[model samples]
Target chain A: MVRFENVGMRYGLGPEVLRDISFHLQPGSFHFLTGPTGAGKSSLLKLLALSHRPSRGLITLFNKEVSSLARDDLPAMRRKIGVVFQDFRLLDHLSALENVALPLKIAGAKNSQIYQHVAELLEWVGLGRQVDAKPPTLSGGEKQRVAIARAVINRPQLLIADEPTGSMDAEMGLRLMYLFQELNKIGTTVVVATHDLGLIKRFGNPVMFLKDGMLTTRKQDELPSQFSRDGG
Target chain B: MMQIIGKSAELQLEKDVSTRYLPVVIAAMIFLAALAIGGLFSLSNAISDWSATLTGNLTVEIAFDPTADLDKKVTDAVELLSKTPGVAAARAIEQEETLKLLEPFLGRNAALGDLPIPRLIEVIIDEDSAIDLAALNEKLGEAVAGARLDIHRPWLDKMVLLGRSVQILAAAIMLLIGAVTVIIVIFAVRTGLIMHAEVIQVLHLIGARDQYIAEQFQNYFARLSFLGALPGLIVAIIVMFIFNFLVGSLEASMLPPLSLGVEGIIALLLLPLMVALLTRFTVRRVVLGSLERMM
Candidate 1:
């Protein structure tokens, strides 16, 4: 669960990139965050991820005030939330299996347990045959799957993905969305930041839309009838 | 805590695909540092030994004793020297003993045969002795025939100056080594940071703590330095041994052979520990410095 109220963020002396943003997500809920480029979507996710402090207002995760948390305590807080980066960000020298096993290892899981779970997840993501391959050698879609697997490997309570389906084909993108749906069904709260309107329409989740630095929330049923006509 | 650091370090190290030779570079740096430190240690020890040998003793020679009562005058001089405040013991060298000492200078078979050598009296001083050379010389003038006092002042001055010079040189070499260590560690840490910049950025974006990120680099550098120090220590010991043997054979009064007693060995053992500490400190500082910039 995450809550942001009147949150504003800026880089140094620059003008605010995210302003007057407000949202709350309950446990096990899924939401789609839709925005155009430079709409402050990434900045908002960064605040929710607890990576950057809000210059104004309150941001809370799992009912704890994150702005008051010490820097050293951030890692343990991060362990409860998993993130799939737009760039994938898999370590190039690490094998796919290692990259996927990273969060569990960071959380001090036993080697045998990590290997077993990572293997099962890689198989589910259709990367079982490329488990030993490094990121540099993997196709864009394969790398995206690997990143997704890594993010969800810990079965985190909150999952945040930025452009999770950007590099994948329609089939792969839909499968990835199904994977996220299954995670939400199992009680993991999911929030995805994407500009892919077709995916959002097909998924039919409550959508949080941002323009410039402001946010507005709309239920799927309340979407304008012409929402389906929006271009990707 | 250690497990977290180890895992994080492994991830960081694995992330840099181009730094396959990092271990080798660290080892080489450590090796060179150890060699420099070991050489300084040996040189300082030798200087200490040389200074100790020259500090307390004096020599007296009766170069010309034409009178038949030379033995009586020698007895009188012995009495005078024994009464002197600084002279603990005085003994006259016999003819045969003097010949044995000169035998090396003049070859054994070709040393001017049966030559008359000077009558020398070797003097040993007590540790607490404070002899006034001018006073002792004036006293010896009336007590013995043709008595020539060689207090070894000039040679002692030269030896002390040489010892001090070596110590200074050794210190300068150590300072140079420390500077090089700092430079190398900074360069290596920076290179690693640059190589893993994406991973670092991702970690930062994901809310990984600064300490967590720094631990990754600190662990890598500590291991690299540890690995480097071993070979440096090995090479230093070997070179020390070879130098010791070479100096021993030369028998140069100016250069004492390298002698590592129990204390010396203990000091050498501590060298690796110093290197490890240096690396840990340097790596930690560099990593923390880089993190400060990130903030």
Candidate 2:
């Protein structure tokens, strides 16, 4: 679960990129965050991920006020959540399987256990043949799938994805969304930020729309046909 | 602790492309650095022992007054030297022994029966004796007038000063070498961090602790420095032994021969360990500092 109350963020002396944002998500909830270009979707996801502190306002995750958490304690909280970066952010020097197994490894999982889970996840993502390949050798879609596998490898309580399907084709994008849905059904809270409205419409979830640094919450049914087909 | 080991292993795997060569390099550096420091220490110690053996005993030379009774003057000087406080033993040097002392510089056949060499008395001081030169000089001067007593103070002082200077110079050189090692390790760690920025970012994003990340680099650098320093140390030791043998063969009375005894060898043995410890501290500090800045 996550709650942000009147949150505001800026990079150094720059103007506020996210202003007066407020939202709350119940445990096990699924939502789609839709926004135009430069609408601060990534910034919001960063806040939820505990990567950057909010410049102002209260931000809570798992019922604990994150703004009050110590820096040393932040990692423990972050370990319970998973993030899929738009850039995939796979270590180019590491193999695809190694990249996916990173979270488990950081969590101090046993090698045998990690290998087993990672192998199954890579196979599930259809990367079994390319498990030993580095990111430079893998295609964008394959990398994205690797990133997704890494995100879910730890079975995190909360999953945050920023443009999870942005670099993939229509089929791959749909299949990735199906993965998120499956995760949500298994009690993992999923919050996905994407510009693709077609995928959002195909699998409707509660929507949070952002424009010009402001967010407006709306039920999935409230989106107009055109906007629902292709996010604004 | 187990978790840290696991994480380190994972990181090593992740950085296999570069880290594969790092351990061998580190081991070799450690060995060389140890060997070099050991050799330097051994040389310094040998110089110290050689200087000590030469200057440890005081020498008293009695110049015979030709006008006086030579045997009587010799007997009186010996009696006075023996009674002086801190005089372990004083005896007149035999004619043959005196000639032997001069053989090295004057050559075996340079001196003949015609040359007049001053009769000298050799004084050996006890290890615990504290020779009072002013008192001994007054007593010996009065006992046999015009019979000068050479305590070898001027030359002894010079040797002591020279020995001390060598020690200080060696220490300064070691300090400079340590500073250079620190600088080199810092640069290496910084370059490694920069080259692996993406990997670091990914690791950080996945909730890896900064200490965990730093340990990986620390281990890598500790290994590399230790390896590189090993060969350098070995070569230094070899050079030191060779110098010791050459100096020993020369057998110069003014310059004592070098010796690597038990104490000297012990000090040399500690060199590699010291180098390894130094490398560990330097690399760890640099890696942690760089990681903190990167974060």
Per-residue lDDT of model 1, residues B1-295, tens digit only: 3542253443457455554555566556655655555555666676666556655666787775454565666677788889888788888877678777888889778655456566788888788667787778777976675787887778777866876777677667767777777677788778888877777866664446666677777766666666666777777778778877887777555566566666667766776567667776787788777866653
lDDT by residue (tens digit), candidate 2, B84-106:
77777888888788888888778
Query: Residue-wise lDDT of candidate 2 within A58-112, one digit each (tens)?
Result: 9989989987876577668878888999999887768999889888888889999
Clashes of each: 2, 25
Error of 1 at B183 (Å): 1.8
Q: Model 1 misses residue A28 by how many Å?
A: 2.4
Query: Evaluated with DockQ, which candidate comes out highest?
Result: 2
Error of 2 at A49 (Å): 1.8
What's the iRMSD of model 1?
A: 2.8
Model 2 regions more than 4 Å off: A92-96, A123-139, A219-232, B1-43, B54-56, B80-88, B95-118, B129-138, B142-149, B241-273, B293-295
